[model samples]
Each structure stands twice: as structure tokens, then as C-alpha cells.
Target chain A: MEEIIKRAYLESLDGRRFGDKKEEVEKIREKILSAKKIVVATNNQKKFNIIKDIISKICNATITMIDIDTRFADLTRVPALNKGLMALDTETADLVIARGRLGVPGSGSMLVILDGKGRILTASLSPSSIVHRENIEDRIKKEIIEALSRIGINLEKY
Target chain B: MEEIIKRAYLESLDGRRFGDKKEEVEKIREKILSAKKIVVATNNQKKFNIIKDIISKICNATITMIDIDTRFADLTRVPALNKGLMALDTETADLVIARGRLGVPGSGSMLVILDGKGRILTASLSPSSIVHRENIEDRIKKEIIEALSRIGINLEKY
Candidate 1:
């Protein structure tokens, strides 16, 4: 029997791999054992700014950004306008993230997350339809908790 | 001297060209002329619903949609997805309408228009971005406009 291989996309701004060599992930994993803060990467000014703004008020962490093509080319020949794939692909991020907009009476986008290795840790494709709606911060926090659990990262201290 | 031959993508929904077989574009042109409202198609269901809700307050044609695949398969490939193409050719579309999102901000999608006999009329890639936030809608509108103009269709009515 053959094992199925899957590649997960991480969000980063430094480069496609989020400035981490394979050795770096090992060191970071050790820090997670007792560290108060976690460092993660995302793509673009718009995306980084959005994530940083939200995460700052929750738990504290240094949100470093890197430049990379979060868009997965292998999924299809065409590139996805959505940024979730990019955020999840290259970084040492405990979780990848994205944000969408709100419009009309019942139209809006969602914030999605992927794990460090390019797997979709958790996702919200279509969230509530309100511009800058309340509880968005809380919702994201909850999703992060669930995603980390799936990846076997415990956030009990923070 | 031989004239430069251009190419394009023609789109239809559920295999129905917008107009009659003898004069394919006339049906769509007529619809536009009689339409009091127009709603652009998008993958966002919320947006679609909102647009539909507001149609009565807006234009008169009511809301009609066409699905686009930014990843719409290349005509030469197996398992063709082009509705217009099938009507004209076991080979190609009058104009290839792009369906999915293009990754680049201002790079847009493509359209290949064909004559009645499946001859290539004109082919053009749409602008990837709109003047507003560079998203999928802007790209599709830009491509549709260019494709229509090349075919000598008046767009102000649309």
C-alpha cells in the first residue's frame, strides 16, 4: 500500500518558506513548550495589517510578515484571488489566517486558517453578513484554538 | 497580405447561448435593451443574493446569472467546459469567457469570440483588476466589456 502525500501551504512574507529552514521549525517547537508568545508570518500589507490588528488585542505575539506566493498553483492552472492558501504554505505559523468583507443585507466574506504544513486546519468560508461585525475577534480566537488542537499544539498557558 | 487572426472565449450558461442560432448575439443584445436591471455573476452567494434582493429597486431585466470558471479548461484539453464552444465547435468558442479568479491584481481573464461557423473572431484577455478593490468581479466585467466591444456590440445598454 502507498501512503498518500499532501502538502500544506503556510502564510509568510519573508519568502515562500517564511524565513525558516527545516531546522528552525524544530527550535520553534521547543519554544512552544513554555513560551508566552508565538511568532507567525502572513503575506502582503493588507493581509498582515488585518491579522495584526485583530491578534494584538487577544493573546500577545510578534506577527512577522514575509513575501511569498500563497496561491497554490497545483490546485489549478488559474491563481486564486483569495489569500488563505498563501498564508498557510510557507511559514512556521501555528495557524494561517485570512479576512473577508461585508456587504448588502446578507453578504460577507470569511477568515480562514491553515496549518503550518499547508493543510487546512480550520476554515470559515462564509461568515455572518455584517461590515466589521462584533464577535469577529472572538470567532477567530475560537477557530485558532480548534486548529491548534488538530495540529497537536497546546495553548494552555496563553 | 493575410490579415492577423485574433482569438477569444465565448461563454454561455447551461449550454444556452444568450441568443438565437442564426444571430447568436442578438438575443443577448435584446435582453440588455429590455433589461431594467443587470446583476453580475460571482462565486459569493451572499453577493448574489443581495444583488437579487435589490434588483426591484434597481434595473428592470431582473437578475440573470452565468457561471464562469477562471479555471475554465483550455479548449484543447479533455472534458471541455465552454458552453458557447460546444454550440459552435467540437473545437472552440466564439469568445472564451473566463470563469474563475485570476491571481494577479490587474492581469484579468481571457475571452475568445468566434464567428457563426466557429471561426475565431477575436481573442482578448481581460484586465485583472477593477478601478476599485482588485477582485474577481472587476476582472470579469473588464473581460466581458472588451469581448463585446470587439464584436461590435454596444455596451452602454448593458
Candidate 2:
């Protein structure tokens, strides 16, 4: 069952398989793991606090919490604003992460991870079951850890 | 040039021609025009103040502002939370209008109008040229009036 799910996930990539290139993934992962700074974009303070607590425990990287509502208030295009914001901070951060609604009925939340160059490295989806519930700190932590692992980032050492 | 731009804009609608049905558009327009209470969703206080001031002068609708940041801070999915919020205030508001980033690079802001049932009645996009600048109160008001006019809501009577 796990293999089937894994295969299905990989097939869903539709030819964009950065994960298939182990060496390249490793290089990017190394750069991310050794980074001095990272930014997480979220409007929810509770989610920010939980993510900050977990990430701080796992790595020594400086994590900045950017409230999407406040930070991008004046900007209309969030993804464009995101790229612009990252471009301004390219000298400081190795990675930037953002999450928001998928905007489709019955669809869930989406997480986007980008490099300093504003290139999307990977994305993950969490269904309504996970996002709509209360007390989801553990689920979010586990999901983040798994997503990082899929991108060749092993948090065991950190 | 103006005629060409209008032609191009109509062409851009393609198959979705809600504006073609005069009766249907008129019905929605009447409902909106007669609405006693309306809610504008935005986090920017300055934008809210400008919208409120303009709307007050144009109609007798009791306008209320819902700060998206404070309102949806606990929820991860904005659209879902929006529906829920509107559902809770169905008795208070006749229409709920939400504005946000369109997620397309170089594109402008999008305004979504939803009924009590959370069904979108109409959507409009304001180009980045108008939305990105500072002190755009008059422009915002003009754009909103134009958007409503396209949906068959003429505020000339008000």
C-alpha cells in the first residue's frame, strides 16, 4: 500500500522530478541545511508560533516569520509579491516558505517552498481533514518534516 | 483605442458571458443596489476607510469592514473561512465582497462578490497599474464602480 501510494505520488509529478536526481537534490538540500536564515510566511500567529518552536528545536537557522496579511497587504499579487520580497532578501535567506488556500471548492491547503532565487523547490497539499481541524500542531510538524525529507533534507543530524 | 480596448475586454470573456443576459444581470444588480448592509473584506485600514467613505456617499447601505488578517487569523484556508464568516452573518449582510491577490505575475487585484450562500455572483480584476500605486482612493472607487457597472449594477440612480 505504501509503495503504491509512493508510486502514485511520483507519477503525479508529471515529468518534473527534481527528487529523482539524488545528487542535485543533495546539493540543494546541503545549501538549505547549512543556510543561516529562512523565512516562513503565514498570517496565523498560532501556526507561526508552533512552526517556530518546532523548527527552532530542529535547526540553528534563523527563522523569520512574515505575516502574509501584514507583509503583503499593499501588494495585490501574492506570488509576485512573494518573489519580489524574496528577491530583496536573497542575500539573507536560503529558503522561503508560504502556504495558503487552494481556492477550489473541497480542495485544501497548499504549501510552497522556494529558494532565494524565488524558484519553487517543492510543494505539498494537505487535505481539509488536516487543515480544518483544531490542535493540528503535531500533524503540521510531521508534515513539514516529511516534506523536507522528500526534498533530501534530513533533520536527524540537526 | 478605447473601443479596441473594450472589444478586447469583451473578447477576453470568451464563453462566460453573464453580461449578455440582461434579465439575470438586472436581478442581481437590483438585489445589490437595494441591499441595506454590505461587507467589504480587507486588512488595510486606509483602503477600508476610503471604500467606506465612497460607499456611504453613493448609497444608504450600512457598510462594515472585515479585516481579513484579524478575522481569518485562526483559519488556514481563507476561502473556507470566508464562507463560514459570511454564513454567520447572513442576517446582517446582503452581500459580501472580498478583494485579494490574483496570484498571477504582473496581474492586478481581484474582487470577488459572494451571495449569502457563498456562491460567487461576479468577479473583477483591476490591473496592477491602478492597484500598485499609493493614494489611489479615487482610482479604487472608479474601478469598483466600473466593475459593478459591468455586472449591470448602475449607481447613477444612487
TM per candidate comes to 0.31, 0.42
* Superposed model 1: Cα runs more than 4 Å off: A1-95, A99-110, A115-121, A124-139, A150-158, B1-30, B38-146, B149-158
Docking class for candidate 1 = incorrect
Look at candidate 2 and tell me the lDDT of residue A4.
Answer: 38
What is the fraction of true interface contacts found in candidate 2?
0.00
By TM-score, who's the top model here?
2
lDDT of 1 at B63: 51
Candidate 1 at A139: error in angstroms? 4.8
**lDDT computed for candidate 1:** 0.40
Assess candidate 1 and give its TM-score to the true structure. Answer: 0.31
Model 1 Cα displacement at B109 (Å)? 7.4
Off by over 4 Å in 2: A1-158, B1-20, B57-59, B67-92, B129-135
DockQ of each: 0.04, 0.05
lDDT of 2 at B38: 78
